[model samples]
Target: MCAVSDDVQISVRKMDMRYRHETLLKDLNFDVHTQDVFVIMGESGCGKSTLLRHMIGLTRPRHGDIFYQGKSFWHCGPEQREEMMQHFGVMYQNGALWTSMTLVENVALPLKQFTTLTRRKIKHAVEFKLALVGLDGYGDYYPAELSGGMRKRAAIARAMALDPKILFFDEPSAGLDPINSKRLDELLLELRDNFGATIVVVTHELDSIFSIANNSIFIEPKVKSIIGRGNPKKLLETTDNPKIIEFLTRGERYE
Candidate 1:
């Protein structure tokens, strides 16, 4: 575990999420601590990404509210909600970089939209962000020209453009080779260890769940709720839930 304090950065309280009038998750509750790499792990079709969408304000819950710093997100006014969202940075599964824009331009977009810095200052900031993600001289390259891993890193650089306090990633390792996935995991750890970022990642990758996560929640699709929570390794050793064990062990017998 990461020895985090009792500070809760994001809290999901009694949350119920649905798709097409079918409940996907009901009465969901969880807390993400400050500076912790919190992972949301589950099988496919478990609403892992759906819960993420709610956390990032892309969608509202059917029954409850999400709180950031103890302030209610769904109940807040638009201006306040926008202000709260400014503190979050999200990298979606597909990298989502604009194909027409160079890496510099893509990374610069957020700074340009959010800050009042001069063009010279924004250029400096953009370079610094790209370098932070190991894309130092590739700023001028288009997204299509880069490798899959590089494109994902570039997306991260853009996410960090405004230096958000909390970073949210949905299926970050979805399309990478094992080496690239490991490298990305290392980068995520670096961000948490060096920069004091509170990261929330939604992924089903077992390697990543064990390697990078200090805290986690496993969403059970059939039950439509979380069946397990806490450190992933500890959960593996202590949890008696067969479904959770099967998931953690890739459907193999744990004993």
Candidate 2:
């Protein structure tokens, strides 16, 4: 097993990215410390998703390194990278559950593929994860049978299937109603506390960011780099940078 010191979970170093001829972000550097709810916040079309894909090895950065638990994800050999990937769990903008699969089956997929656990044991674990996400008895339901909130919860259960060390969420609250979005936020905090997982969230939701983020960085669209870095709440109250303040305060000063 690999050992990561308790202080840092992942590090982004001098990352440069471009699309066609347009540079999206350049020299992006940040560290997501262990067990933090780290937010990557920016307005829409800021390439947050692109950066995330690069971290997950879906896209190669033009220049830079993303370190996972002190191991260079870009520099590692295939076998080493594959070993590193086993520790990640990701949830997309939409729930992204298979419409045909029951909730338990969806959650069980990861465990069945990754571990030697028997079917019986996987079933037990699936039920536990389902219950954790407040879907204790709905594991038999298909994705299409559940409401939007329930589908998101089911997807979260699946993400937690392998007890991942780090969880990545892309716009977790994108389509939910306000109430469901709040519930999802609560669930995220619960997951972080219960699992002590490092969570990297890519979102532009101001309410969610203030409520959940322990640390964050705002991507600057104009400069093609990060403009602000720190606790969202503090930055909201203290930042003089117009873009950072405007983004966080929604152009309204704290009154």
Candidate 3:
């Protein structure tokens, strides 16, 4: 585990994200400090995942920039972008693993492609990553062979295969039961505490929001911008915006 640094690790500056001709978020600005559990949240049509895509360099915004450690994400050269990607570990909402491949093969893919580690070393690294995610002996199993929560854990192990500095999660609790969801939250906190990873999660689950998010940006679809930013708990307690309050409490008034 690396020691925490108070540096600003990620900055979304005046970004305007879009889908085809329709604008999604405009002039969106936020900062992710090192080791912070930052969340992107809002309603169903709010483009939360779209914003994450921009941050991961999958989509180019129509305006403004995203910065990681002082480098412009959209303006960087391909090589630079490739270098930046080495610092990222993304776990999709579905736990996107190939059905044909075993968990071992899946996790080993990154180490095999990115590093020149020997066969034995790669195996050890894969084992270590799987173990880290509490999947110690499930290497030979396929995605279908595991339970839903186990599959998510396996996907997480794959994401950690390269030991990324920033971990991005998209709706991590979407399909899990409350118990499993809580387990994932604990694992995320463990990653932040143990590996010092800066976590950015795109989610609308109130349980997850309260459990994991230290800071967050609530995307308002109608307004096409962030409606709320700060600690999730504080926003839930004190925000005057009806949309934000409705979101935090699921349409119930905050008492």
Candidate 4:
């Protein structure tokens, strides 16, 4: 078993990101603690995904630094970076599965690549992960054969294949019906409770946010920065920022 320490799983200190002179994240500072369901919410184009990329060491910050488990990822050697990334599981919004592979094949690929587990062990592992995401019998199905929700579930299964300590979800509920979306939320909560994995979700869905977020950070569109951080319900009730209030109230006017 891995030891848990007070060090941040993902930490950004005064980080800034820019593309073609446009600032995406400006002076962002936050720490994602161990075993937390930390949601990042914002209007579209507020750099929520950009912030996530920085957290995972995908995009290097133009200024400041990102640390994973108390070590600066930007300064780490390639081998060290790979080791750190192995501790994380990322589920992209698009489900990012290979079209040529069956669901189980997709889920098992990570185990094959990263571990020396035999084919039998990989198959068993894949089956277990698929069942966890409610896709027990669909492992043989192709990506095109599954529904959007099922594909998402399969993608989630693949993400959990390596049993990562932290799971980063990019818009996990996108393009799903209300029922499927709600089911995904329940699965996310179950992941935290069952596996003790820290979850960081990037989303704009009110239902998902209210249902799953224990703590969250709201990025302001205009400022391109986080303006609120705390329990979602408490931040909504006490915040006077019109955008924050508007977001919490589901875009309904409060007068």
By TM-score, the better pick of 1 and 2 is 1
lDDT of 1 by residue, 22-41 (tens): 99999998899888899999
**Top model number, lDDT:** 1
lDDT tens readout by residue for model 3, 9-89: 899888998899999889988899989999998888789899988999899999998889877888869899989988899
RMSD of each: 3.3, 2.8, 3.6, 3.0
lDDT of 2 by residue, 166-229 (tens): 9988888876778868887887888789888888899988889999999999898888999889
lDDT score for residue 203 of model 2: 91
> lDDT for every model?
0.89, 0.86, 0.88, 0.85
* C-alpha positional error of residue 68 in candidate 2 after TM-score superposition, expressed in Å: 1.3
Question: On residues 1-255, what C-alpha lDDT tens digit does candidate 4 reach at each position?
Answer: 123357457777888888668887688888888777899998887888878887787888898877777777877797998889998999988898999999999998889999999999999999998987788899899999988878887888888889898999998888877877877888888888888889999998888888788889999867878899987888888888888889888879665
- Number of residue pairs clashing in candidate 2, backbone atoms closer than 3 angstroms, sequence gap of 3 or more or interchain: 0
Better of 1 and 3 by lDDT: 1
Please list the residue runs of candidate 1 whose C-alpha ends up more than 4 Å from where it truly belongs after superposition.
1-6
Superposition error at 151 for model 3 (Å): 2.5
Poorest stretch of ten by lDDT in candidate 4:
1-10
What candidate 4 gets wrong by more than 4 Å, as runs, is: 1-7
